[model samples]
Target: MDEQIITGATAAEITASVRTLHERGALRPGDALPPVRELAALLGVNRNTAVAAYRLLAQAGVVVARGRAGTVIAGHEAVAQEGYAPDSVLRDIGTGNPDPRLIPDPTTALARATGRPVLYGEPVIDPALEDRALAWVRDDLPGRDLRITVTSGAVDAVERLLAQALLRDDAVALEDPCFLASIHTVRLGGYRAVPVPVDSEGMTVDGLRAALDDGVRAIICTPRAQNPTGATLSPRRAADLRALLAEHPYVLVIEDDHFSMLSQRPYETLIGPEHRRFALVRSVSKFLGPDMCLAIAATDPETAERLALRLSPGTTWVSHLLQRLVLAQLTDGTVLHAIAAAGRHYAERNAAFAAHLTERGLPTEAEDGLNLWVALPVAAKTVAERLVLRGWLARTGDEFVLSERSAPSHHLRLTVHDLTDEETARLIDDLAESTR
Candidate 1:
């Protein structure tokens, strides 16, 4: 036991040992390691040596110091193991992820721009990016008084908007079974979330009316491709919502057009001109790669000014390098081509799966965006568990539901874009079997 310690007394050696433990699966994500005092005593080293080693590991992303929760492994074993698959046996059908093949390679453009040193106080959002983004957003958000602010992502934009608009304990209306991120964001900010119902035509006007009646100060609505459901708001529904919102003119309406570029459905503007406060956030992460992390937030001058105040140049301005990269791809015609191909691919694949389910006597239909929302005869979690047993990972509808005491629906959000025909058919068959 005395001879088991690695001979080197240096801090670098201790850090290397900790990293080796993580690399070899001896440490795993969320697993708390020995305390600094305990490790120091065991290794016959000073407490400072152990502290420095842990800090080095944290910097390298090998471990995280969780304060009272203690230091723990940061990366999962699956991440460390090359090609290690999760328990999901079926091909990945759960995640609402874009096809990696469609993301155009940015390395070529990034390399060309690597020659310059990005200095502080320099323009954060690239001028070229601003020009192109403004033009692109204007296509969907047509109005004379709109101003744009660049953000890290759609989620980032939403968070900042909430920060600027609401104080702690304020109520924000969100679609019931909302996108999980929205739920987490609102909760983390200590705001109350008022649930609004979503139907085939997207968020219901009556639900919004109820939320407003309940005194919600803000509302986040997805006009098309409502996550986990793939429901697009019909024109009639949008008009109805606009009419309802007219009664409550002061409520802030945030229309998240996350699927703007990839959606095959017709665009419907829910934030009517009469509505005094609104912001339309469109993110490129769905159509482009998530690594780009760029979104354009358009609002009226007043709201824009408030949002802009939160985005001071000193704090968090969108990175110029990232902005330039997005601008290069967006303007090159290559990104548009890729988006067209991806949209077609998604539509065809989703249609094929829906057809297979229909043939099996299950009701199914194809919709826009990268994934399909399928209804099953059982609870979504049960269906998801069965799918996992069959080697496929799927997202349960409950994860997106924001309502309380509502009967759980048997719905699974499937990413069918990259599945082969045979694989798609097999999945349908397995799903049929699983439901039974």
Candidate 2:
């Protein structure tokens, strides 16, 4: 065991020591530290000091406390990120955004939105748009009791949902290596985020149950193309999660299927057929363009009514014009075709990049969605530094971490697959060089 991880006389120092080691790649995920008694002896502190340090780390989702197994870094939890430097000379592979070039041109849709102005006291939802939203969302929702509510975007719907269902400091379960926007929303809303680790098969049952046991009032999940990780919940995993959640049926479950039309993955759901208090949100941002700013939120009636209170009168109904534009685009054959083509483009390019990396012994696979989640042998921060020297800007794994901000992560969620074959090859070689 590394003795230096236990040097601090104070609780904060002990925790910070482990953080420093993890950040610079000295400590690794799932690696165990000394036992509490051993750590206390090494630091010449009270046993409570070691216990407090480990408790703090565990609370932050940085470490797990297993009886007899000691404390180990918590792995596979998700979080959000920051963008690349604005004026950098490097080719940025860091931005997690969908390429604007692929966003369907909305000029045609906007111009074709011939709907008349909407007035107050008019039905909150435009009759035609609501019908369209209902049709588009109904198949994915498991229950007939689901109602439609429109929000500016998926983020808006999420914020409204949590605001309606939870009080300040209420615990909310979030996927580890989580969606950045959800993390931001949860924090800004003053709710507590309990990180639930997500694997390739999607959110781990153990993580969700663990959070639920902690009395989390709400859960926000991405059923497909999970942000940063590109994890799509498998059918079996979805079923298992649903079964576990069945015991806690009234806890609010919100599914943000952000990549609906553009996603290649199957629509597996955790809002089981009988599960009450659920919301399924699908946004048009990834396909129709972020400028569209339209999303259809399907939820149980009570949740919908609570969410609707926030969207009343003139305060915040989605613009009638924007709604019509989204409808026009969704209905237009050409626009739908463009969205399909863009989806194929993202998958193919990501697959190509993943394949090249694997050939070079990096062992990557572009499973789904826009970005390729690439694992590196070296710490991601170290690899990112080398990429910067080589004129490439990549997002380090730490950028998306929620609690364990400096965990020694060896992955990069890169959106650089649009690079030329030569550029991809050179970048892969540079990555290997940096690790070596």
Candidate 3:
């Protein structure tokens, strides 16, 4: 609070002084830095020098400019999925992955890979793969001049989309109880994640609008089979979101349909034709397997062009071999049927598990995806500890939150569809007893 504390003649010195303040615990997260003009006068520097110092701090993620609210210390730390504890003798059900047995074998498709080795300066996307992927997304994509760009996975596509357009400290609206990867990606990029609460009908309109008022320049949403919470955007909800987003057409909307082939619900898009900037991404991990590491990003040609800079040939394009394999599996009728069957399997099993819990008077619901989002009667971590004693591993929902500082909620995202009859009964019994 002392004027003599901030001693600096140039931008570098001013930035260093702020960092020292934070390091010494004098300035904590959410604490506002001095105004540009005030700091300039105090440090005997011009206003431009103070502004440049703030910009440096913003880009480095030391502070965030909150429009008229001035700048505040950057406060987000990305949350990582607490993978199952190693060496624990428990039936692990915490991993939010697909049942491996359902994933189609790529061996038959691999032999179909017959082509010349792609060289530098050649086109980045495999032609057949691009064509097929485009057809897959065309039905739901809004723009007439939509373009497709393939990336290693959905996370890669989202990362590239944001990095190409946004600056550090720019606000991004994210679903609360969001996907782990999306949370990690946005926060690690130094963007503030404005939490939008998601209900059974998907992201709440009020939540989205509140975030927009906070000056969020970007939005990341899951239209169907949302992770951590098995919420899907209904037709009415999608229409409301599209209408609200139309007012801010320039806000970049990136929809991650990561459960495309395995989602029980039909593809309902949020991007309106009139909306200028938006993207739709579908990754093959759920259906084919996570190891495939491939996804298709459909966006306006301008965004596609900008995203291409990082995917240019000879630097970071997806491999032609992987493209061929994905294309082969997609076009084959047999594989298509297999994919459908897998979708049904996940839906039926998840529904059954949710039904069992509900029957036991422990509320649970799973509209789609590979997991069930249950409303626990007790703190999920405490229930998780009880499960551990019963030789079961559970994933608590608080780990998926945007702010870990908030009060822990009574929810657990469980991936127990793989359990057998007795295992399910025993786990349900244990869960019921633990709640009592």
Q: List TM-scores for all candidates, in order.
A: 0.77, 0.80, 0.90
Pairs of colliding residues, candidate 1: 89-391, 90-391, 90-392, 176-402, 177-400, 177-401, 177-402
lDDT of 1 by residue, 151-183 (tens): 999989999888888876578999876887788
Lowest lDDT block of 10, candidate 1: 76-85
Q: Candidate 1 lDDT (Cα, whole model)?
A: 0.77
Cα miss at 262, model 1 (Å)? Answer: 1.1
Better of 1 and 3 by lDDT: 3
Put down candidate 3 lDDT per residue, 151-196, tens digits, no spaces: 9999999999999989887889999888999888987898878999
lDDT of 1 at 417: 74
Model number with the top TM-score:
3
* Candidate 3 Cα lDDT to native: 0.87
TM-score-based ranking: 3, 2, 1
The most accurate candidate by lDDT is 3
Each model's lDDT comes to 0.77, 0.84, 0.87
Two-way lDDT contest, 2 vs 3, winner: 3
1-436 per-residue lDDT for model 2 (tens digits) = 5686556889999988888787877777888888898889888999999899987776665676655767787566444444556888998887767777888777887787876777886767777888898888787774477789989999999999999998665789999887779988887675778989989999999999899999999999999999888999999999999999999999999999999888988899999888889999999988876767888899999998898889886768998888888888889999889899888889888888888788888899787777888898889989888888998898876766665654588889898746777888788888778867
